[model samples]
Target: MALNEQLNKFQKQQVKCQSTLSDIASSRTSVGPSRSSVPAAISQRPVATAPVRFSNDTVRLTEINNIRKSPVGSQMKRVIQLLFETRQAFTPEQINEACYVDMRANKAVFDSMRNNSKAYFDGRRFSYKATHDVKDKMQLLSLIKKYPDGIAVSDLKDAYPNVLEDLQALKASKAIWLLYSQEDIAYPNDLKCDMKIEDDFKALFRNKDVPTDMLEVEKELLKIGLKPASNTAERRAAEQMLGVPSKSKQKKKKKQEISKRTKLTNAHLPELFQNLNPSGSQN
Candidate 1:
C-alpha cells in the first residue's frame, strides 16, 4: 500500500478503536441490561492495535516537550526515555546518571517535572505517569491489603517496578499510603517492620503486649538509635526501661547485702565473742 493510504487507514482504525473504548467505558458505567450487554459483546471482539507512527527520536522529543516546555527538552528527553524503557522507579541521582544530566544543577527543572501531574514522584523516586495502568493499580492495592504490617516501598518497587507511578497515584488518592505516616494515619494499623527503632521497636509496644525476648531488647535499643555493644551505658538504660535486669549484677548485690548483715551482727555481739575467748578471760 502507498504511504499516504496506510496512514489514512491507520488513522481510521485509531478513531474506531477510540470510539469502541469509549462505548465500552460508557456501557460499563450506564445501568440497565441493554447497555451492559453491549459492552460484553464489544469486549469479545478483537480490537485493532494502534500503529507506531512516531520514530524513537520523535517519540522521545514529543514526550519531553509534553512533560516540560523549556530548553532542557532534549536533556529531559533522555530522562523520559530512561523511565519509559526501564519501567522502574528512579531517584533524581539515578535519572541524572542514566540521562547524563546534572540533576543537581537542574534540580528546579526536575522538581517541576516531579510536581507536575504528568509525572509521579514520592519524594525519593520518579516515574512517568503513562507507564501505569488500572490493573497494576488494583494489584498494588491488593498487595497493600495482604501485608497488614505495611510492606516496604522498596519491596513494592522491586515487585512492581513498572507500576511505581500507579502506586504514587493510589497514595495521592488516599487508596494506600506509606505505612505509619503520621500525617495520613489511615493505615496506622498496617505495621511496618523497619530497622528504625521508633518505627519498629516502639511499634511492637504499640501493637503488642510487653515484649519478652532479647530481640525485643535489641529492638528497643535500635528504636532509640543505640548500639548494644558500643552504647553499653545507653543499652543498660534502655534495658532498665524495658524491665530487663542484669542477672549477674542482681546476684552480686544480693551476696553483698548478706555479707553486710553478718558483719553487723558480729559487731553487735562483740561482748559475747570476748566471753567465749579464753585469752580474753585470763586478761
Candidate 2:
C-alpha cells in the first residue's frame, strides 16, 4: 500500500508540473501583450482620401478642385470684377494671371470670359485687337515709340517698324499744327488778357510766324497764368523758329507792287496817249 501510494503521489507531482508548463504556455498564447512586446495589435483603418474631380486639362489640375463647399456664386462675382478691371489692354497669359484663375476660377471660368470675345486671339501669344484699322496703327505706334522715324517690317515683331499711316493722318489733320499767324486781335488783345484764355485753350490763337518778340510774348502770357501754345521745349523751340506766314507777307508785297504799278501807269499815261497818234489819225 505504501508503494502504491508513493507511485500515485509521483504521478500527481508529474501532472502538476505538466499543468504549470501548460499554464505558462497558455498565458503566452493569450493575445495579451507582453512587457517585451513593441506594441499591441490595433484595429486598422483605411486612409482618408480627397474626392477626385478630373477636368479636361491636366496642366491646370489644382488641390482646390475637391472642395466640398460651393463657391460658385461669389467666385463668379469676383471673376466678373476682374474682367471689368481689364479695361486696360493685356496679353492672354497676363489676363489669365490677373483673374487669379487657379485660386478663384477654373478652366470653366476662363472659358466664360473668352466665350463672347470675338476680338481676342491666341497666336504667337494672345492679343486683344481693337478694330483692325486702329489695332494695326496702335501696334505700329507702340513700336515706333521705341523705334523712331523708321523701322523694317521683317524686324517689327522683334524689331519695331515705322508706322507712317498714323503719322500722315495726324499731319494732314493738323492736330499738331504750328502756330503760324497773329491775326486781328479782338477781345482783350493783351498777351496777358484773361479773354484770350479760351483761344489759348482751343489753340486758335497760335503765333503763326512768331515774331522776334516771341520770348516777350510768351513771358507776357506766363505772367497772366496763361500757358503758352507750345506743349514741349522742342515744340516751343519749333515755334521759336517759326516766322510770320509767307501768305500774309505775300499779300503785303502784292499790295506794294500794285501801288508801284499804279504810280508808274499814271506817270507814263500822257506819253503813251501821245504816241497813239497814228491810230487816232486813222480813226
Candidate 3:
C-alpha cells in the first residue's frame, strides 16, 4: 500500500511539470518569434528619416520678425556694431544678412545715421568713418609728412576711411610716393632728396661685370667706395625699381633649368649619342 502511494505522488509532480512547459510554449507562440531567434541584421536595421526643408523667403521673414521684436535703439546699435566689428563697407543686403536688420523698414534710421558724421554712405554701401582730425586732403598730407620715416597704409586707412581716393590723387600729382612690401608705406615726395650719381660711377656700373649673387654684388659695390642699399626696405625698393626678380623667382628658374637637363626625351638621344662619340670613331 505504501509503494502505491509513493508512485501516485511522483505521477502528480510529472503532470504539473508538463502543464508549466506547455504554458511557456504557448506564451512564446502568442508573442511571435523570440528576439534572440531573429537575425541580428534584420533586428538592428536603421530607420529612414525625412529631411527638414525651409525656403529663403521664409528664413528672411523670420529674421526680420525677430529684429522687429527687438527695441528700436538695440536694432540701430546692432547695425553700427556690425560695421565697427568688420571695419569694412557693406551694402543694405549684406547688412541685413549679417545683423538681420530690415533696411527697407529702417530706412529713416539709416538715412539719419548717414547724414550724421559717424557713418559714411557712398550711394550703395555703408561704413564707419573714424574721426581722427583728418578732414581734407591737405590735412591728410600734413599727417603723412609728420612721420618722416614713413607712415603705414593701415594706420592712414584707420585715421581716414576715404584715404585711398586722396592717396591716389596725391600719387598722381607726385605729392606722395608708395612703397609696397609686407606692409605698404607712404612717403611725402617733397621730403625726398634725390641722390646725385656721378658720370664715372654710372659708367663703372654700366661697364662692370657684376656677379648675379646679391651678397657678392654688395661686396663689389663696397670695394668701389659705393654703398649698396643696406636697409631691407631700401634694398626691396631698389630691386622693384630695377625690375629685378625676387630670390624665390630666381630659385624657381634654377630648378626649371635643372629639371630640363635631367629630363631626356627621344629627341635628346641623338645629341647624347653624338657627345658620347665626340671623335666619330665608334664601331
Worst 10 residues of 1 by lDDT: 182-191
Between candidates 1 and 2, which one is better according to TM-score? 1
Q: Estimate each model's TM-score.
A: 0.24, 0.19, 0.30
**Per-residue lDDT of candidate 3, residues 155-189 (tens digit):** 77756557789988988888888889999999888
Candidate 3 ranges beyond 4 A from true positions: 1-61, 68-78, 81-131, 158-161, 191-283
The TM-score measured for candidate 1 stands at 0.24
Error of 3 at 53 (Å): 23
lDDT of 2 by residue, 202-277 (tens): 4543434344455777776788999999544566566658952333667865544432123345552243233332
TM-score for predicted model 3 compared with the true structure: 0.30
Off by over 4 Å in 1: 1-70, 135-283
Q: How far does residue 215 in candidate 1 sit from its true spot (Å)?
A: 91
In model 1, pairs of residues that clash are 149-191, 150-191, 197-223
Clashing pairs in 3: none
**Candidate 3 weakest ten by summed lDDT:** 271-280
The CA lDDT at 139 in model 2 is 53
Residue 4 in candidate 3, Cα distance off native in Å:
99
